[model samples]
Target chain A: MKFVLALVALVALAFVPSFAGPYPLGLGIGVLGYGVLATAWAMFSGPTRYISLATVAFFGLGAYTVAVLSETLPYPVVLFVAAVIGLVVALIVGLATLRLAGIYFVIFTFGLTELVRQLVTYYEVNVTRTLGRYVFLPLGPEHIYWQLLALLAATLGMAYWVRQSRIGLALRVIGDDPVVASHLGIRITRTKLTLFSISCVIMTLAGAIQAPRWTYIEPSIVFNPTTSFLVVIMALLGGPNRLFGPLLGAVPLFLLFEWLSANFPNHYSIILGLLFIAIVFVLPNGVLAAGESLWTRLSRREART
Target chain B: MTTISRRTVLQGMGVSALATALSGLPVLAQDRTAIRIGYAISKTGPNAAGAGISTTPNYLLWVDDVNKAGGITLSKLGVTLPIEVTEYDDRSTAEETVRAIERLATQDNVDLILPTWGTGANLASGPTFDRFGYPQLAGTAVTDMAPDLVKRWKHSFWMLGGGHDYAEALVALLVKQRDAGTINNKVAIASVADGFGIDLSKAATPAFTEAGFELVYDKTYPLGTSDFAPVISEVAGLGVDTFVAFSYPPDTFALTQQSVVANFSPKVFYLGVGTAFPIYPGIAGPNHNGVMGIGGIDPDSEALAAYFERHTALNGQAPDNWASAVTYASLEILAQAIERVGDIDREAISAEISSGEFDTIIGKVKLVDNQLRSLWTVGQWQDGKFVGLAHTERAGAREPVVPKPAWVPAA
Candidate 1:
């Protein structure tokens, strides 16, 4: 039943580009882009409880790849290159840093973003002698929307596959108790690295798909640390443990931010910060957890009646 | 999807209504009461300080002043239409900028769209603005791609001349100082490793060498370098008579304060972006007087005085001496063009701007090949006022301050 509903919703969303104009299509593009990122983010960080802030590093690599190569290479080839780059970088970084957990891991991932940004900036300033590159691609808003929608579908499929597979069971055990998981003969590091690499590649693809919309690319714009923070926030607020939790969090929050930024530009940041604090306090385990508790209580009351 | 379909239906109705009104424009001239203008700019983010100081204030001031004077008179309609503005804060990100611009154009259906602040945002939205036939009078963007951009986007206009233009103009002034024997040909140059800084420093090095000046010291510091004492000391030790730094705001303030602390006063001291900011004088104190930077305005111009007074009165702070006036002048050009066309015909307005000359606070302004060629490239702080030191048109520039006055330590 849930799978059927999910399929229905996906089909409905797929039809948005057919009816919606530029403005709604623009918002849809943002929603779907963030959806893919948050979903992929949760795929790794959800069960393992490892907060990785290197989403933008991969995202930026993807974007910079497209910006540099899109004009000379075919779009599909550029995207594939972006994904390959993201995969290799993530594998190397995950292998090196997956041992460190908790705050240490968080700080490393955060630093990783800055490291990539600075490296790209240095290369641009020294090698290219140019900072910003103009991305004159044939892709328009509809093209971006369709591509992101398709990416979101692929991300969901992979995420669901991970959730249902033995890898998912091993990941859950690893999250529950790593020592116990080791006793159970699960290769913890391999499981974590594989998932992390996949998640990073999804983020990279999302960034590549959205780059043409920007029409210009620079280190600061693509490698903005805010992207990482927003992804984490959206994933957390939606109950990252569930398959659809990140999307649940992303859609409303993206719309709410749009409304807030539109209505109160001066105080939107303050309001957004307040809302985040409120969400953390009120929905500590996320909306899905809260909803599950409500369902349990209602079922108990119905049984009593 | 349901909500989207409903909104699309409403939009369709709105479009039909607009079409009907356009079809009966002779009868609906009186009904066209307001000219709706919209813009999305950085109001609360990394670019807020720049947008607030150089761009936003001018936009607000121009809109207010135009409405106060009974709005723009439409000679064809024989009626004056007040300007109505819808603003969005872009949060200084490309995604938000693109979305907000699209919303302004398609959702709000604004009659005209004003430019956002910065080179990237303007360039990011250039294709959109061109597709919608909106004239993009970019006041703050400085790029060598103006000629190419103008050709690609017909309605796009560049106000700030390229970095090469700025370098050549400053080098011209230095050549004059060299000819007068007020300073030696020895020069030191440093630049922040960012787009604006790199472009200027790259251009200046070649221009200075071409103009026969000895390049004594050259270096580049990263974007957010807080400590500049070492660089200042190194350059000071080099005994270079002229010190130029292509820097951003924080760096400009830091370099000036640090230079004062180190007593590294050169015969010709120059900085970049933040030198002409209203806050620079307060930060640099007495040391700001002889400091030259990227842009300048005619401090003695009567039009500038009025603009400054009005801007300060409206915003409770003085506009920057450099881009603020130019930004306001761009709006003035837009308003004049709209009035000249006597209607909200975007194509006509764009053509009017391309061809017409208008009196601006910066003086009579015209776009040659959709680029404003005549502009102040070098400015110096003189007697608490940032004054134009050199111009591309070779007119209205004040005499260069020879052997810059010693930096007075703040009491």
Candidate 2:
């Protein structure tokens, strides 16, 4: 059933390039790009850990990897390489902070993201253009969409594997109770760092994909707080613990945002904000979680009868 | 057992169903009478302040005035008809802006579309409009890559001069002064790091070098820079007489204020679009007494002045910047095209816009051989106002205020 659903989604998205107009296609590309980031974000930020807003740091790193690599190869190849590079860097980042508790890891990621943005801005402004010798290349929007799609698929697939694997159970145990897991010899620090690095790798791929989509990128887009907020909302909307939850959140929310903006003409935020606040308040586990649990309970009642 | 909650659920469903049904109700522009126009502008986030001040207010006034005068003269139909503008706020984001524009173009089926101010928002909407083949006349976006975009999207026309156009104008103004030998100007430089400024600075280098000006000090700082004391001190020490900065509102204001505070004021300060905006002069005040700017054409512009005056009188506000004039001119040109094409038809409007020349409030409007030929040129700030100063007589800024009313210095 899962494979069938995943296959259907892939087929729909594959042809999306041909059928969707630039406007719709551009929005699809954006949602998928962010969806991948949010899904990777969910790798650590599920209700288990409560790691809020850490995805942006990893996302920014991923974006920068593409910008740095795009000069040598095509953007799509640069993105693939960016995913690998992200994994490597994430390994390093995760190793350093995985020992820490909730707030420390969160703060670590925040500080690192801001630091990366500042460094990139300084390098681009002072060194890259000024030197005239070290110019950074920019990409067009269509090239960006394809790259984003590739990254989205890779990140989603990786998340699915983690969902069904032993490592996934270990991460869940760490998320549930790191103190208990430490006693059981789970090497809590090692496990966290590995997960953090993996998350960062996926984020990097998303960023690598986006560089060409907007034609121009700066620190703001890659490491934006707004992006962090959207990813959180996406993950939560999709039911953070569930696989493909971010996709559910990102696509529907983005498509709805576009549809509302187009039809109602800019009266989206008030509605979206209200909807978010209401849902979070009333549906504690989110749409996917609450709906799935209800279905499960009803099926159990029928089985007993 | 819980019929009340069940009833409430049904009620909520009923409300949502009603809302959806009402939403689908034809928001389409009704045919006949007022020619429908659409404007998508950023009105919410970071860039919203730019639009609220610059673009939207001007649009309201332009539409009102055209309505007050009965309507635009429909040349083909030979009857003046009212113009309607279906307005949407893009919420100051690229994603939102593009969505708004698509709705306006597709559903509202507006006779014309005008996108608001900023590089990011405009760039996002460019391909969308190009695909739809709507002749989007962008008023305030400084998209340097527009000439290439124009190839794919022929219907699109940019009212404001290109970034390079502005660059050459600044360089030309400095050259004219240098040739005349009043100002000790020998350098063309800037303090903007964003794409707008960097691209302009890069393009203008060859022109400045060709014109024999010394390339003294060109620097770009990050956006939201605090104290530009170091860059300023360096440029002042280098004796870089003309400080050229291409920036948006805040950065432009910051650079100017820092220059003033640091007391490193150059002799002939030139800027990109920021200098032309009315907001900048107010922010800089008398400190902006002797600056030059690269800007679009505004008629000796009683039509626009009246547009501004009426806007001020009605809303207790002045037109935000020269963008008001450009957006107003764009709609005026578009209306002339539609009316010339006669009945509501897309191809006819395109053909008319491509091969039509009609008089507008902003002098004569013509898309000669498919290029928007309503001319544009640079202007200088003479006593706080951006007075049209270059090739005005030839470009038609000449009149009773002939050669620009004494207070305006010759460029």
Candidate 3:
């Protein structure tokens, strides 16, 4: 039943570009990108209970990779290279921080993003001797929109698969008790690292696909820490435990951002912050969980009547 | 079997939410008779301070002033059409800036569009503006690639002096001072790492070296840096007699304040962007005396005095001497072009701007090969005002106070 519904949604989204105007198509690209980031982050972090904050590091790496290599290689080839780079970097960071848990892991990942940003900035100044590179892709809004939608669909399908597989059971055990899972013949570090690397590839590919839309890339703009935090907030706000929660959270949140920014540009950030706080307080488990509880309660009342 | 699954419920909610959001978007009304000018300006974010001081008010003032005189008379249509402006705050990011401009062009279908606040924003949106056939008379941009950009995008126009020209004029002034024994031949340079600073620094580095001045120190710092004490100390430690900082507004103020705190004053102190702003003098107090920066205006012109009074009256603040006057002059050019062409067609207006010269508050202005040729390139603060210093061949050119006085501590 769930697979049928997911197929219907994907088919419906695929046709959006045929009828939508430039403004809606542009918004569609951004919203789909955000959806991919949030869902992919939830894929690894939700089951393993490892709150990784390295989305920006991978995103920036992918963007810079395309910026540097897109002139010589085709964009599809650049995306492949970006995924390989993301996988390699993720493995190295995951191995080094495997022992650290909880707050230490969070801090290290946060610091890693800042470290990568500064290093890229230094390299651009000292080695490249240029402020930024201009991208001249000939793709229009409709083409970019379809590409992002395809990426988002792939991310959703992968998330659903990971949630229902044998590795998913192993991850849940590790999240419950790492030492006990290790004793029960589960390769704890290997399982966690594989999931982390897969998530990184998805995120990096999203970044690579979206990079050309910017038309120009600067290190500061590409490697912004704000992107990392926004993805985390979107995933958690939508309900990380479920396959579709991040998607649910991302669509509405990004739409709200677009509306607020267009109407009240000055106070949108403050309003967004307050709204996050409200969500955290009222729906701690997420909006999906809140809706589930509401539906169950109403059904019980209907049965009694 | 009849129960609604969680995934189905979630998909239903997602589709409905998107529908609601899209439906809520305000439809832009299309009035064919009105002269609609659209723009994306930085009302909030890193570039907002500069936009607030220079770009946004000129836009508002121009729109209001035009509408008050019963709009522009279109002899082709035999009717006078009132001007309407639709503005969006870009939040100072390149992505948002481009998105806003695209919305203005495609969604609003504005007949004409105005340029944004800075070099990067203008350059980022240049292709889009060209594709949409809007005449982009960029008011605040300074780039050495102006010729190339104008060539590539035929409808685009740059109104400010190019980076190379500004650099040559500054170097010429310093070389004259060097020959006169007004100061030592040693010079230090630092700039922000953004496009504006990078272009100027790239132009100045070789120009300073070619003029027989010793390049004592050179560095570039990232934008939004609040601490310049260490960099200032390093330059001061090098014992250079002259210092030039190609900076944005925030860093401009920060670098000067830190220099005063570090007591690292040079014989020739020149900063960029914030130097012509009234707030700079207000913050630096008496220390602003003997300081030099880019984009000087004629301080004694009666027309400028009147424009300043009107700006203060309309916006409750004085405009920056550098970019604000050029911005207003660009609007004046646009207004005259529209009136002369007797139509609101983008191609006709662009051709009028390209071929015709017009009188403006900044004196007679002309776009030679899609670039302005008449404007001051440098300014100096003397006796509580920023006076014209370099590029004196233009109108409002004044002799500079050579060998700047030593910096004074605030009382």
TM-score of chain B of each: 0.91, 0.83, 0.91
Q: What digit string (tens of lDDT, one per residue) describes model 2 on residues B1-411?
A: 333443443355346545533543445646567778787776667777767766777677767877887887767666777877787767665555665676666556676777777665665566667657777677766655666656756766666555666666556766767777645645747656665666677778778888888888766776677666777787878876666776656767777777777776566776666677766667776666556666634545677677667768865767644566666777776766776666666667776766777676566766544444344456666655676655422442421111122112212
Per-residue alpha-carbon lDDT of candidate 3 for residues A111-184, written as tens digits (9 for 90 to 100)? 99988777887777666666667676776767777878888888888887888898888988998899999999
Query: Which stretches of model 1 miss by more than 4 angstroms?
Result: A1-12, B1-31
- Give the C-alpha miss distance for residue A187 in model 3, angstroms: 3.3
DockQ (CA atoms), all models: 0.30, 0.24, 0.28
Writing each residue's lDDT as its tens digit, candidate 1 over A1-305 gives: 98899789878988888888777788789889999999999999999999999999999999999999988999899999999999999999999999998999999999999999988888877777778888888888889888998899999999999999999989989988999999999999999999999999999999999898887788878988999999999998888999999998888777777766766777888988876786776676777876687679779999999
Of candidates 3 and 2, the better by TM-score: 3
TM-score of chain B of 2: 0.83
- The models' CA-based lDDT, in order, is 0.87, 0.65, 0.82
> lDDT per residue, candidate 1, B217-288, as tens digits?
877788889999889988988878899999999999999998888888899999999999999989988778
True contacts kept of each: 0.49, 0.11, 0.24
In TM-score terms, candidate 1 sits at: 0.93
Q: What's the C-alpha lDDT at position B122 in model 3?
A: 83
Candidate 2 residue-wise lDDT, A87-196, digit = tens = 87677766666676778867776777777677766787766653111113454445567666766777778888888786788888888887787788877766666667
Candidate 2 clashing pairs?
A62-A204, A90-A197, A94-A193
Best by lDDT: 1
Candidate 3 Cα misplacement greater than 4 A, ranges: A1-12, B1-29, B392-396
